[model samples]
Target: MQELHDAPLAPLTTFRLGGPATRLVTATTDAEVVEAVRAADESGTPLLVIGGGSNLVIGDRGFEGTALRIATTGFHLDGTRLELAAGENWSDAVARSVEAGLAGIECLAGIPGSAGATPIQNVGAYGQEVCDTITEVVAYDRTTGETVTLTAAECAFRYRNSTFKDQPDRYVVLRVRFALEDAGGLSAPIKYPETARALGVEAGDRVPAARARETVLRLRAGKGMVLDPADHDTWSAGSFFHNPILSDEAYAAFLARVRDRLGAGTAPPAYPAGEGRTKTSAAWLIDKAGFTKGYGTGPARISTKHTLALTNRGQATTEDLLALAREVVAGVHAAFGVTLVNEPVTVGVSI
Candidate 1:
């Protein structure tokens, strides 16, 4: 375990924004992690658990409590079962799985975060979400002062949310176990249309696992979803907003509003989310609402390569980013009658 006082947090996140924490603890093992958490809890100090820092947005005021950075290292693979420490780099783990000829997580390549955080938000991209392959999450329950393993079903995963996210302070994820497929070294059937098109295969066709992983990484790089320090466009938390899933009645009202704003013939992109629910693209909404790519004059702006990402252009504050996000949300709501919600977790701030 390593401790620092008043540590700056911007350098830890992909966004490169945010202030400092009163105290920062970096734990390199599960035991250290638990001990750190227990200490904070026992002392009645507010605790903020951070892994990868990709999906986090800390305010300029910074955290006044203990910010525990999970940096533990553990990667145990037996046959098709894989267990990773909470702090393992997510993209690197995906690459390792692909190298091992695993077929489950190839599509999740280039997602920025730790393996532990994947379950927290049920992290998904390119038609793949972690909830599909994740078998269990071992977490230290702060409230009960005990470590528990919860099955995937018990996690209560929904679109970009889970039990851990719903009760953020209850559990500190320590390890994640996944069940991957061998598939004779071939990838899982391609589900996302864009990925399939890029690979020149029909949806449901399987390619080499490594090829699938590389292709997704390529696609992500093109859209600035992949982290690249040299590129301002990549200085983002992947997608700034979640695709809004609306009820049937809400979808009907939104479609009416879309037509009202974009002429009677205008049609919005909609996909079936679940029974009587439709998921519409937040990127499409932002673009149609007149906030194009690179849509801001301030330090914080939408990525030039992707409309979904809100980035920090070298120098930006959390307030600047939030301002841009709020503008985009209001503009989209005004134009389409649907409000966009942020994907990243915010601290000491609301949008």
Candidate 2:
């Protein structure tokens, strides 16, 4: 275990914008992690658990508590079953699955963050979500102070949310287990239309596992979802807003508002979220609401490559980023009667 006092946190996040923590502890093993957490708890200190720092927005004022960074590494594969430590880099793990000829997780290839964070957010991309393959999650329950394993259903996985997210302080993820498919070294049937078109295959067609991973990586790079330090557009938490899923009545009102703002001929992209629910594109909403790609002129702005991403262009404060985010949310709500919600977890800040 490594410990630092008054540690700067900006470098830990993809956006590179937060302030500092009163104390930061980097744990290389599950034991160290639990010990550190217990110590903080015994002292009655606020605790913040960070994995990849991909989905976080810390305030300029910093955290006045213990920030425990899980840095342990473990990757064990038994046939089609895979277990990863909380600290394993998620994107790299996806690539490894492809190399091992596993079918699941191939579509989640370029997402940045740690494996532990995936279950917390039920991370999904290209029509594949972690919840689809996750069999169990082993976590240290702070409430009971014991290591407990929760099955997928018990996690209560929903669109980009789970029990871990609902009770953020109650559990610290230690490891994640997934059951992937062999599929004769072929990828799972392509579900996302964009990936199908990019691969020159129809939806539901199976391609080489490696090819599918590479195709998703290419698509992600184009949208600045893949990290590239030289590019300001990639300096963002992949997608800033969650695609709003509205009830039947809400969707009807939103559609009416869309027609009023855009025109009778215009239609906002919509997809079935669940029974009586419709999921509309956040990117489309931002663009139609008059916030085009690369929307802001400030240090914080919309990513030039993707409308869904809010970025920090070299020099930006947490406040600057939040300001742009608030602007987009307010404008979209005013124009289309749909309020956008941020996907990243915020500390000492609200938008």
Candidate 3:
């Protein structure tokens, strides 16, 4: 275990923003992780569990207590079953699985974060979510001070949310277990229309695993979803907002608002989210609301390559980013009666 006091946290995240933590501990083993969490809880100190920091937004005020950075390393693959330590870099692991001819996670190849954090948000991309392959999550339960295994069903995963996210302070993920498929080196059936079109394959067609992974990575790069430190557009938390899922009544009201504003010929993109729920494109709403790509005059702005990503163009504070986010949210709500919600987890701040 490595420990530091008053540690700067900006370098830890993909956005490269945030202040510092009063205490920062990098735990290289699951035992150390538990020990650190227990000590903080026993001392009645607030705790922040950090993974790759890719999906986190820490405030300028900094964390007042312990910030535990999980760095434990383990990757076990028994046939189609895979177990990963919380600290394993997510994108790299996806690449490895592709190399091993796995079919389940090829589309998630470019998402930046730790394997542990993947379950936290049920991280999904290119129409494939971690929830689809995750069989079990082994976490250190802070409430009971014990390690417990929760099945995928118990995780209660939804679009970009899970039990771990709902009770952020209650559990520190230690390991994640997944069940991948071996389709004789073939990828899973393509589900996203864009990906299928890019590959020149019809939806539900299977391509080579490597081709699927590379194609997804290329698509992600185009949208600034893949991490590229030199590019300001890539200095974001992938998509800034989740696609808004509204109830039937809410969707009807929103459609009325949209038609009233954009004219009878105009229509907003909508997909069935579940029974009686509709998911609408937040990117479309933001654009229609007049916040175009690369929108904003400040250091923080929408990514030039993607309308949905809010980015830090080298010199931006958390407040600056949040201001741009709030502006986009308010603009969309005023124009279409749909409120956008942020995808990244925020600390010491609310939007």
Task: Give the best candidate by lDDT.
Answer: 2
lDDT of each: 0.93, 0.95, 0.93
1-351 per-residue lDDT for model 1 (tens digits):
899999999888889888999999999998999999999999999998889999989899889999999998888999999999999999999999988988899999999889999999999888888998999999999989999999999999999999998999999999999999999889999999999999999999999999999999999999998888899998999898999999999999998998888899887888999999999999999999999999899999999999999999998999999999999999998888888999999988999
| Per-model TM against the reference | 0.99, 0.99, 0.99
Q: State model 1's lDDT.
A: 0.93
Prediction 2 global C-alpha lDDT: 0.95
lDDT of 3 by residue, 219-298 (tens): 99999888987899989888989999999999999989988988988778988999999999988999989999999999
Query: For every candidate structure, what is the RMSD over all alpha carbons to the true structure, in angstroms?
Result: 0.8, 0.6, 0.8
Model 2 weakest lDDT span, ten residues long: 259-268
Determine the C-alpha RMSD for candidate 3 after optimal superposition of all C-alphas.
0.8
Pairwise lDDT winner, candidates 2 and 3: 2
What lDDT tens digits, residue by residue, belong to model 2 across residues 1-351?
899999999999999989899999999999999999999998999999999999999999999999999998999999999999999999999999999999989999989989999999999999799999999999999999999999999999999999999999899999999999999899999999999999999999999999999999999999999999999998999999999999999999999998887789888899998999999999999998999988888899998889999999999999999999999999999998889999999999999
Model 3's alpha-carbon lDDT is 0.93
